[model samples]
Target: MAEWVERVDEQDEVLAVVDRAEAIRRRWLHRVATIVCRDRAGRILVHRRPDNMSRFAGQFNWMLGGATEAGESYEEAAARELSEELGVRGQPRFVLKFRCAGVVSPYWMGLHEVVVEDQVRPDPSEVAWHAWLTERELADLVRHEAFIPDAREAYDRYWATAANSKRP
Candidate 1:
């Protein structure tokens, strides 16, 4: 069965629904939601994508999320992805959403944050491994250019937003 995803425009206005593969193959602008889980230490949780996957295979992902289903909002999608992928559930704090061309295709990506205290049992098919890292530690790894491009953008944008908010 072909997975379907919602296609949106630059302004996030819904245009139509399309097959996920065709959307990627044609570089259609689509909606994606990412969930960034953090522990008490402020360490971000990262997951390694299985090598056999289609997009960013074998690379570590900064967020846990996927495309928005036909009628779902970004927030709903993020929460659902979190539960489905990591075996956890919570209301995530939405950080940002931006339209960008990335490793998969051009997408309007929504970045979300979830501070969790429960066990995370990642879906073995989607995540091969997982780890928690501080900002500096993640930065070191990121310098090696191993992240999915759009995720890197979201991370940078999240930090930039955080930094700006801290201004006194």
Candidate 2:
């Protein structure tokens, strides 16, 4: 089983330490990633995490991503997750980072984006459903609290930066 590490609440300046294995087994202090993909129409791809997931099960979320391995770079972790969870190959662009505080399981999240033309084959164990949505649609979902809270800020950041960039 993978081990977990005690996470520092950087914003709150709180310090605590716990057994890594116990933390993960107990669903505490997880590290995760968010993958953002867009089509020619400028619609973003989102997916629902499998209900079997330990936290936020069945939650509508961004594309293929997950926890980072020990000593793995965030970029490498993102790429691996993109291929593993979505069965697609492409380089991922690092975009944003956020922390979600939980009573028992705080999460540190990394966000990445990639543009691709290949079809997606989501891993059933990881993803339950997926959809393509425009920025406006995503914003509406955020307004209604339909998406994962930890990912909303990253999504918004991606949307803003993507809109400003000249690259399609």
Candidate 3:
């Protein structure tokens, strides 16, 4: 079955519903909702994509999420993606949203954060490897490893916002 997504405008208003593949082919803006998972110790969960898949296959990512299906809000998409990718559930708190000038396709990215206390059962087709890492370790990997481009942008923005929140 063909996957569907809402093509969105610069203001993030919906333009139309289209097939995901067509949206990619046309470089139409859409919504992709993601969640950054952290453990109780404040370590972030990172994962490597399987080598066999397309679009940034074999790259590392700190966020787990995907295209928002038609009529799905960003929060709903984030929650669904969390369950689909990690087999763990939690209420994802909204963090930020931005337009990602993607390597594959441009889209508005809605980012959320969740603390996962349950054991993560990763879907092998989506995650080849998974680990919990300190902020320092993840930052080091971001500097040295092959990471997904759009997610790297989100990571930087996520932390920037986090740092800003600490200001007086």
- Maximum-lDDT candidate: 3
Stretches off by above 4 angstroms in model 1 are none
Give the TM-score of each candidate.
0.94, 0.74, 0.97
Give all candidate RMSDs, comma-separated.
Answer: 1.6, 4.1, 1.4
**Clashes by residue pair, model 1:** none
Backbone atom clashes (below 3 Å) for every candidate: 0, 1, 0
Ranking by TM-score: 3, 1, 2
Tell me how far candidate 2 lies from the true structure as C-alpha RMSD in angstroms.
4.1
Q: Supply the TM-score for candidate 1.
A: 0.94
**Candidate 2 lDDT over residue span 1-168, tens digit each:** 544334435552224554555655566554666678877677888788888887788877765676665556668888888888888888888876767564345677677888767898988998888888887777777655656766666666666776787545
Regarding TM-score, does 1 or 2 come out ahead? Answer: 1
lDDT of 2 at 147: 68
Best model number under TM-score: 3
Candidate 3, residues 25-127, lDDT tens digits: the string is: 9999999999999999999999999999888889999999999999999999999999999998888999999999999889999999999999999999999
The TM-score measured for candidate 3 stands at 0.97
Model 1, range 1-168, lDDT digits (tens) per residue? 888888788788988999988999999988888898999888989888999987788987778999888889889999999999999989998888888778768889888898988999999999999999988888877656667777778878888988988921
Instruction: Give residue 75's error in model 1 in angstroms.
Output: 0.5
